[model samples]
Target: MLVAGCSHFAGRRPLLGYSDKGVQHADTAIVACAEQLQYVCGITGVNQISTWEKFNGGKTPWVRVLPGRQVIRMTLSNSRQLNRQDVIIDNVQAGHVYRIDVGSSGTLLTATYTDLGKLDSYTIHMPRFPLEPKAITASF
Candidate 1:
């Protein structure tokens, strides 16, 4: 029984996940420039990972993006923000690091962009989803 109990430890570490192939963004990709993703600015893949490390306890199929060499996890859940049907994740400030709380079961994903040393900041808000959202702009 002891051996069976230890089975949980025999697998890949946490804070790691994989999305479908053909993700259409590298670092520095803006929403208007690339395929419109509802929740991520940059994602990690071959020749595209800005940085990816071990992050734990998030909903399945979340995308990890690197806006400024920092990791931000995008999650979607039923957890509402401010007791309303609005923001589930919030970035109160910019030019800093923020750890997204996955345990909250929230239902939105937000990313904040700021021109440092300036008074300009922009944030993107999107609904929570289990699959990587894609925007089709062209066809072959």
Candidate 2:
């Protein structure tokens, strides 16, 4: 497991998408999720981030991604339960900024994202705290 705060160089905010080689800032877009309701967990084309980074109170408000079509997966939680969601953003432009918004009605959790201009968005919803096989195994 990758622990949060593993290195002094790895600051509280983590950079997602792209590597240490040949990255052009002009061609990259940033996606942010400011609400504590959402915790970004995976990017479709990238490796899964450490769970500690996702759930251990580590702040992941924003992430960098190559401008294009991409899927962002995250978890939404309330006091009683947690749910997972995915937002697919298409036609993301270079140097643009986006944000994910999380909301809930009772046990139904919803996540959505829109560009800075509020022109486009994608959303997903799921029931809070659906049974997970891993949870059962872990409890044993």
TM-score of each: 0.19, 0.59
Task: In model 1, state the lDDT of residue 95.
Answer: 26
Candidate 2 structure quality by residue, lDDT tens digits, 1-140: 24423322222333565564477555667666643434433222322432224443443345667767777666666666577677788887866667777777767777787677422322222112332211100000
Q: What is the lDDT of residue 15 in candidate 2?
A: 53
Across residues 18-110, which tens digit of lDDT does each residue of candidate 1 receive?
233353333222211112333322222212332232231222222322233333333333323321111122322222222232223344344
Model 2 residue 137 distance off true place after TM-score fit, in angstroms:
41
Give the Å shift of residue 107 in candidate 1. 8.2
| Clashing residue pairs found in predicted model 1 | 15-55
What is the Cα-based lDDT of residue 25 in candidate 1?
33
Residue 105 in model 2: shift from native, Å? Answer: 3.5
The ten-residue window of minimal lDDT in model 1 covers 82-91
State residue 9's C-alpha deviation in candidate 2, in Å.
Answer: 8.2
Residue 41, model 2: lDDT of 30
Superposed by TM-score, candidate 1 places the C-alpha of residue 133 at a distance from the truth, in angstroms, of 31
